[model samples]
Target: MIKALAAKAHTYVVLADGSVPNPTRNAPGALTGKVNTVLGILAWAGTAAGVAGVLITGAMMAISMRRGEGSEHMGRLGMVLGGCVLVATAGPVVTFVFG
Candidate 1:
């Protein structure tokens, strides 16, 4: 009990003097920003891939439909495949944003 009281008193003394343990850190370090930039580039690339997939898929759908029944299924398959590619792109985007 005495030890506990002494510890509390010591903390109070420090507080009264306006001193804190582990002062606010000002340095983010050099590497932190560089790492962020690298991740940002990767994220942009992934987003670009998603956009390309969606556009290519849409184009394939249009061309297939114009070609008639023979290509209609192929066009639809392409669209579905493109959607998958786009959805997959989200993972990298999130990693970049949150990482």
Candidate 2:
């Protein structure tokens, strides 16, 4: 079975014109501007949400501390910070992988 499948597989190195075929990478032609605008808006929203998360978490932590409670809010703060890190790195990681 493996041998038969291997024999059926085809690999093209050159085209009929004796030229090497190269894959092209590009964004969509017509909606490129709109797509970029949407992406920018989403990025901005993610950043704003992250900021709000941190601020809220900080406030909760401060209130908890004032009550002489345990450091339970630390976990929430850590989660907020982790989310901020993810938001910060998402665009760069996607660009590195696909660009």
Candidate 3:
């Protein structure tokens, strides 16, 4: 049974031209501009949000520091900075990998 199954699989795997098929890479049409515009808007919004997060976290940290609780907000600040890094790198990373 194993031998028969292997033979069947071999037959199916052998293509008529012995070449692998490749998909056509075509540019996105019609809605491409609209899609790009939306992506740009989202990117801008994300950057703005990151800036806001950092500013808010900084204010909180400052306030907490006055109360001698500064260390507690360090984690929140780190997270906000990390998010900013991610938002900044996401587009370039995606383009580098895909293109």
Candidate 4:
């Protein structure tokens, strides 16, 4: 009886195909599409805001320097640096949020 059971189990195992199935074989549905679209919009907005911030900060720094306001110039330079950081980090931020 024990041998017979073992043989039957072996036959069952041998009958199964060895191919592994993919977890994400099916394409994402509507919800995924909406999420991706929202994420894309957020990324675009962030990039635009960062660029505008950088431009405004640069102008402020230039004006401050022209007036010889050394302290204000440094502050404006810091803002410009921060804006650059924002631009550089936007993509990662979006991925972090949506991924």
Between candidates 3 and 4, the TM-score winner: 3
**lDDT tens digits by residue: candidate 1, 9-94:** 99999899988566665657788788778867876776676676667767776776787745555655566676667666766777
Q: Comparing candidate 1 with candidate 3, which one achieves the higher lDDT? A: 3
- Displacement of the residue 47 alpha carbon in candidate 1, Å: 0.5
Angstrom error at residue 62, model 3 = 0.9
Count of clashing residue pairs in every prediction: 0, 0, 0, 0
Q: Write the number of the candidate with greater lDDT, choosing between 1 and 4.
A: 4
Model 4 Cα lDDT, one tens digit per residue, 1-99: 999999989767766656543445355698789977997897788778777877777787778788888655567667667876876787788679645
Better of 2 and 4 by lDDT: 2
Tens-digit per-residue lDDT, 1-99, candidate 2: 987665555333234448765679676776878977888898999999999998998888888889988877878888888998998999999889766
Q: Give the best candidate by lDDT.
A: 3
Poorly placed runs, candidate 1 (over 4 Å): 1-28, 70-99
**Which stretches of model 2 miss by more than 4 angstroms?**
1-22
Question: Pairing residues by index, what is the TM-score of model 3?
Answer: 0.69
Q: How many angstroms is residue 90 displaced in model 3 relative to the true structure, after the best TM-score fit?
A: 0.8
